[model samples]
Target: MNIFKRTGKMALGSRLRMLTAKFTDDASSIYNLYNIDMQPKWFPVFYVLSERDDVTITEIAVEIGHSQPSVSKIVREMAAKGLVIEKKDAADGRRNVVQLSAAGKAIIVKIQDQYQDVNDAVEELSAEANHDLWKAIEEWEFLLEQKSLFQRVRERRKQRESGFVEIVPYEAKYQSAFRELNVEWISTYFKMEEADYKSLDHADSYILDRGGHILVALYRGEPVGVCALIKMDDPDCDFELAKMAVSPKAQGQNIGWLLGNAAIEKARSLGAKSLYLESNTILKPAISLYHKLGFKKVTGRPTPYERANFQMELKLG
Candidate 1:
């Protein structure tokens, strides 16, 4: 039974493993034809050693994109087979370096024809298909580096969960909730300064009454997140996106993202041209979210809070 055929893309890792196993099996047979005693799995490390001399296992692992332990095991096996020599590193006594032995160098000369034949075969195989699997794999690796499959799936999940959340305008009943949420979040990461108290203690008088807006996220009819668009007097920006916080119990459901988007739209609806924010660099996830929301760092703006180390601004039409 072909489990991958039934599982489809969900079995991608398994399918790749199966294909690699087949390739490795064929490669071992090919090595036997050349009278070479080597495992197919050691080919990457062996080839790396053939090109370089006196390389550490960590260097080889990085070069071949394998783990240090895996590379170390292969180096030991090669040393056992008399194909490579291992010695303590002169610069670092704790580490060992490896290089091709005389036998290993001779094997490289003997396999020059085999390497050429393999390359030609790979080219021919790629040409036989309309879509080149080799090129596709390279492009896939590049894309995965930019945004992995895990992140892509997580985004989809966030999108699904965000639909269940409702962004509502500020209400009198949620006044304390807004204050508590922000206070809890801030106190968890930093001390609550006077500037924070001035806003949280009287959000309505300081924010809502002064041509600003506040957004609250409701999950199951309960407030789980909040963000404020405080009207700014700066010449460069119209509003400051401040006091964003999400409840720990309702975290990971994209509540912060939803509230942030809602707050931006609220500001834009109020004829805002740009938005600014103040935050510390220690809040990496929040900084990343701000970047994702199209915010860019800017200097020369003096901060009111001692904890704020960076300021970001988002230009809006």
Candidate 2:
């Protein structure tokens, strides 16, 4: 039976429960396929509770964003399984505090080791697949959070007619507009210097000389956004994607994502094995886009580059 069909009336909480049920099944099936006994859900809850054994049931529910009754039931089940024990709060007799039993702790340790085996099997399948799966899950979480904010914005805004937006490769005629958009976006968000902004045009020329491409987003013949793909000079390095900028006035319309997708496609066409980008935390929207695009965070930072304030990379097929 469809879990959502049964719980469709309860709104967000029910939807969350449905999602949990779906993924819980997936995890259990994956473990069974590998002849493993444990699934993934218990660890997160166990780890959280184990850290603060005296934490109240209400606190656990809040920390995990589950209903109080739901958490209570789960804790009761865990207690029955000898995985957790609930005791009266020392300070508040009416309140119950949860702690992991020794058996529970042992199970978590074994699960942690088994998780490495699962990760290894996943990595062997394809790095890109693993990255894409993780990204899709994260995007689902983000959209759920944004639903309320989107509804609030819709309540106050007039519905405008949709208009066409064109995307074109960067050219001399659109150079000034392209530069202006980059300058405005970087300056406002990153506080980058004028010289650093000016250097981007030069860097574009350098990239073009090495078989890389740059693209611009146009709105009715006016350039409003930009992104670029540059083949790496070092044989050891993969193609570098850079200079992604969307006009502040043109944001919230999904233009940045469109530009990014174009860049990734272009890189793939160029026979690149990996695509990398440089960005900063100040540009939160851009960072979010990178994450949505399946780019994972890495430890290293970018070298000195005209458009870069930091760096992230994604492996491609």
Candidate with maximal lDDT: 1
What tens digits encode model 2's per-residue C-alpha lDDT throughout 1-317?
37667766446566768678986887888767655444365555676875677777788888987888877878777788888888898888998788888887776556666578768976775575536766776897788687865574554341220144567877767667766777777777566665455447675556666677889877666677888787776654577777678776777666777788878887777778788777777677779999999887765653675655567778887
lDDT of 1 by residue, 108-154 (tens): 98998888988998899888978989889999999999999999988
Candidate 2, poorest ten consecutive residues by summed lDDT: 155-164
Regions of model 1 farther than 4 Å from truth: 29-35, 51-59, 87-97, 109-131, 193-198, 219-222, 231-238, 249-254, 273-276, 291-317
Which parts of model 2 are misplaced by more than 4 Å?
1-163, 193-198, 305-309
The C-alpha local distance difference test score for the whole of candidate 2 amounts to 0.71
TM-score computed on alpha carbons, candidate 1: 0.75
Give lDDT: candidate 1, residue 307: 95
